[model samples]
Target: MFPPLCCDSGVDQASRRRHHQSRKMAMLSFWRDGLERQLAAVTAAMDTLQRQIDRDAQSDS
Candidate 1:
């Protein structure tokens, strides 16, 4: 088992748990934002490629 970080009373443990949860939520939010931006960029690039393909198909016809 992992060693205890500190000698935590009930109130101290509750406070520490809340602090950890808040930090974890903030980190998740940061990752979600980065992923959203990446997805948007990928979608835009795909759209551009699709347009180019359509243009080439029309020219070939």
Candidate 2:
């Protein structure tokens, strides 16, 4: 949850900026990790399909 915005509060703006930046970085890292996992799965599937295709071609020849 985001902190409530106040009109006359004394919260340090620098600290708020740093907090937001850290959250953004964390989100980027999480997405990057998820993308890497998806890429690996796709690569593995492609390799399997290639092998299957090769076997079928050899059998037909």
Best by TM-score: 1
lDDT of 2 by residue, 1-61 (tens): 4654663356587877787789989999999999999999999999999999999999999
Strongest candidate by lDDT = 2
Q: Candidate 1 clash total?
A: 0
For model 2, the run of ten residues with the poorest summed lDDT: 1-10
State the displacement of the C-alpha of residue 2, model 2, in Å, after optimal TM-score superposition.
6.9
Report the Cα lDDT for candidate 2. 0.86
Tens-digit per-residue lDDT, 1-61, candidate 1: 2335775676576777777788889999999999999999999999999999999999999
- What is the lDDT, from 0 to 100, of the residue 55 in candidate 2? 100
Tell me how far the alpha carbon of residue 1 in candidate 2 is from the true structure, in angstroms, after superposition: 11
